[model samples]
Target: MNKPLAERLRPAKLEDYLSQQHLVGPNGSLQQALKVGIIPSLILWGPPGIGKTTLASIISKESNRPFYTLSAINSGVKDVREVIDKAKQSGGLFTQKNPILFIDEIHRFSKSQQDSLLGAVEKGWVTLIGATTENPSFEVIPALLSRCQVYILKPFSKEDLIKLLRRAISEDDIINKKSVTLKETEALLRLSGGDARKLLNIFELVVTTESTTSVEITNEMVLSKVQQNTVLYDKTGDQHYDIISAFIKSIRGSDPNGAVYWLARMIEGGEDVKFIARRLIISASEDIGNANPTALVIANNCFQAVTTIGYPESRIILSQCVTYLASSAKSNASYKAIGKAQQLVKQTGDLPVPLNLRNAPTQLMKEIGYGETYKYAHDYKGNFVEEEFLPDEIKGTTFYSPGESARETTIRKELKNKWGLKYNY
Candidate 1:
């Protein structure tokens, strides 16, 4: 049988594992558990090609448990139950010897399918290990998610990827037969996008395609051997991040046509509707802001609607919201204001709240000058009062400068009218 380079290079023991030292290191969280041979039901969350499955396999072997595997893309509730039944027969309940059930892409499982595993997991019939690229809080059902401890796997760093490449060349039986030199790796690293599997696959392709056994890998050689633009949209790869960036930028730039085109690409590529909708909500606030307050309401509704009505139908809702946001006036004043305020807080660590602004609920607190001499805005003529809200030390700092949009321009005039240059509005 012909096996891929990534599969053949998979590490069977924790000592052979490359990255994720925080979890598998000497004093790591899982290190103690692995040493004692008692593994917990866990949800391994991370990007693609980051060793989630391999880590799960190592845990099962180290714990000396029977291993059962299933892919959520193909398996249904029935398949889940069958595996659980065999696991129950294989070992005792609540024991370290319980079978380890590994489910890849557990986020893809529907509510009913996930519900099927809850009983098996709760009874300790199986030590469930689920791997997901999506956030478990959003994708996994709450009941099932609460039952498993979530361990995040970080993306491979540039140094980590380079170490993996060197290990492959020196250790692989087939590759060691040939003389391979990595003259350059910029193109290889860029193409892999921090994914180890993609990196090795590209490296192997570059090596095997060469006519001679002596392979000298360069940026040019690697790029030429690997096919570019083959994948229209890779949900697990670079296109997932790049296309979303394009889609958001198009909206921020007020190009409705560009926005809809990128949206179409994502929709056709099977990008998660909720993921697309969530970005639109952020753009509505951070990009559109007070320029058109209605944009936020529309974007928020788009999220609620799409989550309820998924796929083919949600695409129309997404297109409508995308076009509306692109056509609306834009502003980043609110976003910048919060950022500046946060920076100020960090600089002036926990300044005391002004006495007048403090609430006085009891007689003892009232005597301490809380709410003393504080003017009520409602008692004023225009339902506004010139009160100092910020700490006295940073009293006159102006963080929010209204953007040059019609609505915000009106707001600028109002602020200038109220404070009379106190904030230099």
Candidate 2:
């Protein structure tokens, strides 16, 4: 009932903040930034509980700046504006830096919500710090992302977790009063899933499960307490990705029941609607490509629809998309073709276009034999011609092979008719 052990032991200063040495070490960029008196807007991207929030707090405290925090999970444009307005009022009083506006799980914020922060960050009304577990490149809008510095926080190293366990037992007022001995930590660390806060929470739970004055933590003790009290849907942890993977795989495997079940799990967990819609889009292309070309259209429209209509209604839209994709015929031919094409490109860098295939837009290009011998497919019989389209070196290459699905079968037949054995269709 008292403050959780993780909260009780949260570091108040940078020196006390554990790990992330690359960012906070003596030779680190952030350390130098604080020393040199320049604090740019930042995006802290990483897994759960590696001191992202704590570090943000330490930065605000060290600089003596007014700090405002927002969770993109629940906060909206109105909430962001209200916080920015308060920061702007107090920003003038502080000369060292603007008031800090820190948003946790910032990847959950929509385009408009993120746009609301742009003006404040641009005019220096507040210094924006956004934390995200997902890759900011995919989740954050480019305009807002461009204005911030991105620092990746890795999961705590084994050594760092050990240091944290030792520190908690020795330093925390509530934990220390219990006088627990961390005799073994392999299970404790494992159950924590490389999360610092998880490690401490599990440690606290293992020791404090009983009212005994002295506690001994072992692998069995850690597991016993944890299995009894572990949360099922930790939205910020591994379960989030696991359930989404299940949902995508279910759709790909054409199991509407499984797909909808996982979709419900994500929806019930308060997963971001855009995140679900975006994944559905990728699944449509990657798994349901050409076999059912219309799948992508539905997924795209689903993304657009969910973006306009959020939450409860968005869940309905997602359900319809999920079930439709699950029932659609699946194919990966187009996806594989592009992947093979990219690999070939990387292997042969900047292969020159064949002269006949090159566009002769200017007289000089035409004089250089560009388009000189090119066969205009339109002018040819059946609107097709058997000419070398690829560069001379890889002329006979077949990067795209139709899958065994019906649509791709038709595509293969058409190519076979046109190119004979050239396409290996």
TM-scores of the candidates in the order shown = 0.93, 0.87
Model 2: lDDT of residue 326: 99
Can you give the lDDT of residue 402 in candidate 1?
Answer: 92
- On lDDT, the leading prediction is 1
The TM-score obtained by model 1 is: 0.93
Q: What does candidate 2's lDDT look like per residue over 1-425, in tens digits?
A: 79988899999988887888889999887898899878999999988778889999999998889999999878999999999989988887335678999999999888899999999888888999999987899888999989999999878889999998888889888788887887888997776778787778778777777679989887887777877886731544546656788899999999999999999988887777878898999999999888899999999999999989998888888999999999998889889999999999999999998888888889999998998998888998899888998997787899888888888899899999988877778
Q: Candidate 1: worst 10 consecutive residues by lDDT?
A: 229-238
Positional deviation of residue 255's Cα in model 1 after best superposition, in angstroms: 2.3
lDDT of 1 by residue, 238-327 (tens): 467678899999999999999999999898777778889889999999998999999999999999999888989999999999999999
